[model samples]
Target chain A: MKKDEVPQDDANVLEGKLKTLKYATNEDGSYVQVQTVGWEPENLALSQAWEDIHERLEIIAQDIAAGKSSPILYFMEKCLMEPPMLAKHMGIGTWRVKRHFKAKGFAKLSQKRLEKYAYVFEVPVEHLTQFDPTRTS
Target chain B: MTNKFNHRQSAHCENGVVSNLLYHEGIDLSEPMIFGIGSGLFFSYIPFVKLNGNPGTSFRIYPGYIYKRATNRLGIKTKMRTFRNAEKAMDALDANLEKGIPTGVQTSVYYLPYLPSQYRFHFNAHNIVIYGKDGEEYLVSDPVMDDVTRIKRSDLMRARYAKGVLAPSGKMYYPINVAKDFDLKPAIIRGIQHTAKDMLTIPVPMFGIKGIYKLAKDVRKWPEKVGERKAGLHLGNLVRMQEEIGTGGGGFRFIYAAFLKEAAVIMDMPELNEIADGFTKVGDRWREFAIMASKIFKQRTNVQGDYQLAADIIVDCADQEKVLFTKLRNLKFPA
Candidate 1:
């Protein structure tokens, strides 16, 4: 794929988040190197993939609101985790995790269970329960 | 800031850091060249080895292998050290930066605030260069990023000490001396031969071209074996391995093709360009596989096609790669 090349005006220009490349030429007897930076097609594709994941998260958040899904599902997708992995991280059984996947069951979870889940998701227990997309997402 | 370190970003992090470091040492090489020389291309699907509760699928070799192998092959003596303490690690990094030497450090992407929030995972093998210190933040030339990024000392320390399978362990590396007259042909030949041999000669069913076929077979049975939701997540991680961190676009086939394009010119063999084009087609096939996977994964619907179809596409990719690598291994160059 052809990469987008942009000039490097030091490191502070792009808030340190863009992709760039520098090229060197053996065209003549002297080797001349020119610095440039820009986005490649792959970059766009990657960003698109991330955006798609966010869109899914948005839908998942809505599902949580509409009682169609549990907030656990949203956290799982957001953290790119699976039930089995989450179970392992929480040091609990997969069946227990399946139960926690329900909103009602999640609400009745023990404080210890909530703490385990909160630590695994790297969020506070309150935020884990009262998940606001604006605050966390 | 000292302009001695000419940072250039590339498609992949490890190889990009290798290229940039080599350039700073006055031995200019492209990321593809470094990648090819390191024999960085690989494929593995180990169902027994679980990561994130799914089968671990890998598109390339381990993270630092490319830099290590490429530098070693070029007869470059590099200083690589791992610190037991974060403070010592920072001291070592500062010591090197004080001498105007850019240091390449292994870090976790999860703690890197500059990365897109979604792309940050618990992966601890990300590579970046610290060229200078600008106050509380360090000047980091992350190869996967477009420009130099700044990070607080605490964040950098956290990233260096991030916990995972392949933990960084506060490791940092820099070339102490690079050979002034390193030859190209032998290194290129070795790299090409090594890749072709590994891909075509590996007897294990879980590795190389056979691994791709095995993954296809497993993908077909994913839903039945693991149920619907797990199957979707498994396939998603499989593609995430391919697309994220420079694997998704035809599994870096295009990048290798670019290497071949440069190699043809470096070796004065125009025919390699034609071979490069052939590999590009193979890469295109890999992209097609990713697209099919995304369609099934994102839509969460089995209406258009099933995992069986995606697996078949990958089997085809394996077959095509077999032919490409075979030709690459057998091609003759003037001595």
Candidate 2:
């Protein structure tokens, strides 16, 4: 069958045939899922996800409260991207990007890095530092 | 926050002194002066009043007179010199207030850029009070409304003052004064540090199962509820982190994802199985997008890489459920 022509019954049958599967989709039109025999355990795992995120986020929050610089800087440096490129990749706005660098006392470095990364990202310089990265995702 | 609280208390003490001095000595203070002591910021004349006969409407009176009057009434003597900065200004004011009196003076001073108005920024006033000194650093009581706060001169130097209020035309107000020989430095400093610690340590339990259930209720309706929760969590984290880090940066994404996830889950209503199926399909795609975005962010920002690693270990421990969280938002809540 063509990509969108698969019968609903056939799709359901195929999904049921897979003993341990929960199908999902991808941007490229591919299917993905999680399948496991122990439904209860899986459900519990899903429930605990928020706590996991909170725990990790708390450390960063603490570091922030202690007057430490944002860990994003270290992460970007490690990733080999200039600060602006990293900011762009993260979907932060230009104004906010500048403010972050300024607040961290690294405006000069941030500005320089933005120019360097603009070429590598192959997008407009403006696009590299657009308003919100998360929106696109 | 501690500094802010202590400053407020000290201000109250100063206000009492001013009130007592006025009642007992029959010293007539300008309305702005009284308001200054009341609100911890200077007030402008409201056209009906005149100062120095200039038909003066809107002017900030110098705070020195209030300090001098209070000290003189209390029979305290200390050297006074005008300083260029708020810190020096506070020290001179405090010292003069504490002079021969066995008890040191507690006073809070605030600077406002312009007269308060409906259109003006709500919190344009910045306050500081001197309760004592420690070693080389003067201990300050900050009118932050939290609790007693003491801060080092060094820390205060780094802290931002009300920019507009510090300007030439900004009104300066002094609301509190004290005449007690109590050294409150240690307490104030302890308070500030404690507040910082508390903010950092506060826990935020994500209601994941409830969030998911809400999402499963209706996708179209999910955004608002999820947005509200996400905004709350994000703001909480931001405030705490700003205290810890001294500044917040590039963390809005975490909030955004939480909001989106909540919306996605809500869209997957069980009643609309067909729509729910489509939503699940789209949800997977959204999850993949979130993961890709997160990876890109990690590659670019490198924020909390170690923490991310730890989270990865936990994800592994939980048998790596293929929920959108681990891959996308990097946060997981209890189901």
Candidate 3:
């Protein structure tokens, strides 16, 4: 039966039941269900536009989990230049970038934020900075 | 200068020849030599045995100021160690008036055996006395250097042979007069406790950030009023933020998301045509869940004395919505 043809109450019930069964499985078992949710037409069409933009972000996270992110070298290159240009290129606000650097103990030029910055550049959807939208550039 | 060396060398050397040779060199030769022994304090020393036998020995070394009195007398204190080669030992002993037994006390030069090959000979051997005119050089009775040689400050610094002198092998011994009071147990306990507390407090934000990101992804398609394009952008931004900031809220994801939500509400472009009503309900639910998680987090911090409970709240919320959000996004909404 098509998802839209199904009654709203029935869909809600199925969703709740599937959810219960879904979370019951362990981490490995949940992957199929996770993908299935994204594949459903009632959901996919509504979120497709944004999903494309987020694909890079998902890939970056997967890279981080897989240990491919290099936070050190990136920050090293960043340090040899002005903070503003680096922030702009990275699509984050300068203050936010600075805060991240501070928290990660990269206060010195030798320190790098390769992994963290990789994740940032990879995901382009969020507001990477603290710039007030109302403020004119 | 002559009197002090004569007193320390009298027990180890009896020959007048070595003593005469040192007097010719312009070295002061009298000051008691002091050497910093590394692991020497652990092996043949008294404190090391005490500390190993009773774990509380650390208290004396690091007593809290408030409990100084109670811990001060817990262990013996000793003067630092020094050495003299055979040449200096003979000369100083020969110049002394008091024969047989001297006025100053002579302590053993204790060292370790497993030291790097360069130091093996000095390991646990009685090689020298604390005498020499220059005060920095050791007149050695060394079996390794042979024929009562003189070793300079540079040689001693590079000598990795004496374990007791170089490393604290958990032992210490010295003249009775040089002993002091110390306790070792409480100090060790305090160190362990401080480290444990630090580990517990610093990782909560990372967990919260990841949890919220996952929550946003699950509810991305639920808000139809925000339109597909806008909702997608919001989710994309969230994913981006998670990658950049480490999805660990560092305790700030909620505030940031709230602002983004406001932007969505104000823009009102109506891109979510097919599933507008369903999307609104899901958006409301997502907001409610986030607030609930935040409340639980704050309460856990206040009552439980840790962020574990708060992190668990996030994990639980994520677990609950994982399937629903995925399905919502994948399914086609009726126009």
DockQ of each model vs. true complex: 0.15, 0.01, 0.02
What are the lDDT figures for the candidates, one per model? 0.75, 0.30, 0.27
Across all candidates, the chain A TM-score values are 0.69, 0.30, 0.23
Candidate 3 lDDT over B264-295, as tens digits, reads 23333222222223322333343333333334
- Flag regions of model 2 displaced more than 4 Å: A1-137, B1-128, B137-150, B160-172, B175-228, B231-335
Off by over 4 Å in 1: A1-16, A19-137, B1-4
Considering every candidate listed, which one attains the maximal TM-score? 1
Q: Candidate 2, DockQ to 2 decimals?
A: 0.01
**Worst 10-residue lDDT window, candidate 3 chain A:** A29-38
Docking class of 1: incorrect
Please give the lDDT score for candidate 1: 0.75
Better of 1 and 2 by lDDT: 1
TM-scores of the candidates in the order shown:
0.77, 0.24, 0.15
Docking class of 2: incorrect
Candidate 2 interface RMSD value? 23.6
Q: Candidate 1 vs candidate 3: which has greater TM-score?
A: 1
Residues A30-133 of candidate 1 have per-residue lDDT tens digits of: 11223333223333334445555688889988877886667677777777666765675676787888787778777788888888777766678877778787
The order of the candidates by lDDT, greatest first, is 1, 2, 3
Off by over 4 Å in 3: A1-137, B1-127, B143-147, B160-335
Say which prediction, candidate 1 or candidate 2, comes out ahead on TM-score.
Answer: 1
